[model samples]
Target: MSKKINEKIQSIIKQCESLSNDDIESLPNYKKFKVFYSKKSHKTCDIYLLCAFIFGLLAIFTTSISYIGIEHVLYYSYDRIFSINIYHEECLAPKLETLIDIFRPITSCDICQHIDHIERISNITREEFEEKYAYTNHPVIITDAMNDWLALENFNYEFFKRIYRTNSSALRGVEDNCQFFPYKNKDEFETLGDVFNMDFDRAHMIDDDYKPWYVGWSNCDYSTAYLLRQYYSRPYFLPERSESSKLDWIFMGTPGFGAHMHIDNVDLPSWQAQVRGRKQWTLRPAPECFHICKELTFIVEPGEIIILNTNVWYHKTSVVSEDEISITIGSEFD
Candidate 1:
């Protein structure tokens, strides 16, 4: 390689290592990998080095994400020669094309109760919902009907966030409260039961900060056959089902202050509803979008919900207030 190219490659690698938090968040995710090769001179080196670097990066993405358990591997530019096995389950080119389809708007369901609408029925429109329930400056004034019908007290703000940091499917903690049983049938359940030989109720309970987080599928039977058999104590949340057949739920809590940016591996749809406090969400679509949407964040009020596909996008939340409680639920679909 030429001297100039060597200097450039070294510079790029140094910059990649020195990337600031803002710099990382600002750049489109796809371009992030390119930071490895950005300073290199295109003329000096043949494509072989680039291919080698890309392969190395792919190996890194796979290994790193396995530890983080993040499934999405975003790329800025595609190269046929250097790329390894397809990072995603679907074909590479088609995956990018299908992003829009996965994130389409969430429609209202007749059977499942919509807790958000109750905030509106009190003569508050969707437009005014945020301002009225604004968690920062204002208090969430609840009507008697809302308090009673929705079982508002069923939620304990303090307890929920405590559970979230430990119980969430997103975390990579020692306690296996959130286990991944991928089989889509009854046999999978039996296999899981036989291999772990766990009591469904007891197996998922983990001591986090001296408390425990319970785990089970919404569809799983708690009353009948016991896998992790312990007395069921946590709140039972039944997330809305999809038009297909996938089952999932949203996990939101009072993130009191700063939360980190991350993605999930499970192929599911999710949304965050501002239940009690204010939350600012910074979200970026898949591939090369950090360049396009430099200022792509929206603050959510107490009642409104924001739809997000965790599989394809990366998002962060800001608290901006003390003792503020926010609730965001994830919606999973088939």
Candidate 2:
């Protein structure tokens, strides 16, 4: 075996030395290997290239399986086992639960002390907030922030119905442009009125035995946007004259039903104000933050504002009381 290996090495060396100096220089780590193998071994190089090609093909195949097929299998399997429709097209991404379980031994770290409670402030200056929290990607709840907003006093189901439903002309462009997301239901509503008219009371009663049913939609219509501005002013904590898109979102539902765990795909941070009832929010750091920080959970009462880096955290919200309907209005900002 020793003699045979020596003969093979000698053959490789001779083959390696036959290549031009320029060609040899082009090869990675060529100078180091040139001391022993002075010739190019086309067979050996072909074998390595073949192995890389196979690996590349395998990577593409695996990704296709994961993205196109695995989600469907997992979705149907989960639905069959639980007898519930918990899967949504928006949530087809690989779950953090699975990733955590697989990588916990390697990724787990000390729970960050700051994760215990989001910073609570009553009268923080915009400069102070932007300096401490906004730029740092920290989450905070500003208590007594929207105390004077008319939305706190007049914004409710009836208020919206009176404003938008009464004037069909105002909703002409917006009624069909927005998409409605229903809690665990696949039904799609074409307009805001259709969503408001959902059998929420009955759904709330039935949700006692099943997962909670919630619904939400974005306020993208020009008339609806104008209507919302009449009741709610921008929170005092946000920077004055900050540029933000006119698109805002409204979430309304009873307790036990709300948004599921997911990160926002927005370009900037966001603030959500609880205009009615109360909401409990459970926020987890993005998978990248797992090694440095732990999850944070808290509640936002009516009239309170929560400013958070929704783009960096996986968060979900649920109403605190079943009796009182929950209404929250949120918008993104720079």
Candidate 3:
């Protein structure tokens, strides 16, 4: 408060600075003085406990999930997550049949044992498909099932990006309400969202040094599905009494990249409509029947829809041409 006090403080500091380290340490005050510490507070512990409890609940919380012939579907219905009015009844159809089919065991080994080639057919009626191929292990590529569909002429990379741009189910190709498979592009792209975000040249592979990407994801958005359904309808060959899941699965990418060899655990057989480019399907028998069955490869051209029980077949796919990007849309029917 006073000049005298300031002088006294400076003198004490000078004396302390002048003292040797050993002298300062030897002081009685330094030796007897204690470092005061209050008891550890429970506030920090409470905060950590609260955070752990929250995380535990979040871990148990899950999104809607059911098999729809896609690799695996983490798909939920529109009504569960959004306030939008329902439009498609297939979206709300009971998954109990799918669940039952998933657990049902295949009793016959004769199906795969005698299979050697994928049958190609055309102008087949519902009775024909049901009698010959629907319940059989023979994979078939129907040549005319997609002939009347507009998807053959208009479905492409750009068209897909435009329709799904506002889709909440698969926003940016992330798993908002659905699942996405990057396939071979997993190293470079984590999701369909990443592939769509790339530059024009790289995305279409317009240059020599471009990177190739192949991806697949389920279409769960009701509005987007409605737009897609306009371009295509049920295959004429599917049994008239069969049930169709409203969900659609899409695979799109440049040539030289596609899905690797893998077996699916879906509830039923699926069909893939080749809308733009040629794709080769290589089917291998399941491990149990490998000794008796052989691997078969078939090329599906544009406007062709291939129906195979992917659940029992280990399959691999490759783009068949460099001239066009491969685009396919498919769904499961029971």
Best by TM-score: 3
- Candidate 3: deviation at residue 19, Å? 71
Order of all candidates by TM-score, from best down to worst? 3, 2, 1
Q: Residue 252 of model 1: what lDDT?
A: 32
TM-score of model 1 vs. true structure: 0.33
The true-versus-predicted C-alpha distance at residue 276 of model 1, in Å, is: 2.3
Structural similarity to truth (TM-score) of each candidate: 0.33, 0.62, 0.66
lDDT of 1 by residue, 158-249 (tens): 43333334433322221222232222222223222232333333222232222112122222222221221221211112122323222223
RMSD of 3: 16.2
Off by more than 4 A, model 1: 1-153, 158-175, 179-258
Q: Write the per-residue lDDT of candidate 3 for residues 243-267, one digit (tens) a residue.
A: 8788899999888888988667678
Q: Residue 191 of model 2: what lDDT?
A: 46
Model 1: how far residue 321 lies from native, Å: 4.2
lDDT of 2 by residue, 1-334 (tens): 9999999999999988898878879988976787556445766788899999999988976777787796665656556554334433334334445554444433222333366678778888888877887656778888988877899888776676565563475444445565456654434443456654556555344555543446677767776688788887877877776655688877887777788886665688888888988999998865655767778778898988888876567789888875767889888888
Say which candidate scores most in lDDT.
3
What candidate 2 gets wrong by more than 4 Å, as runs, is: 1-114, 164-172, 188-191, 199-212
The lDDT of model 2 is 0.71
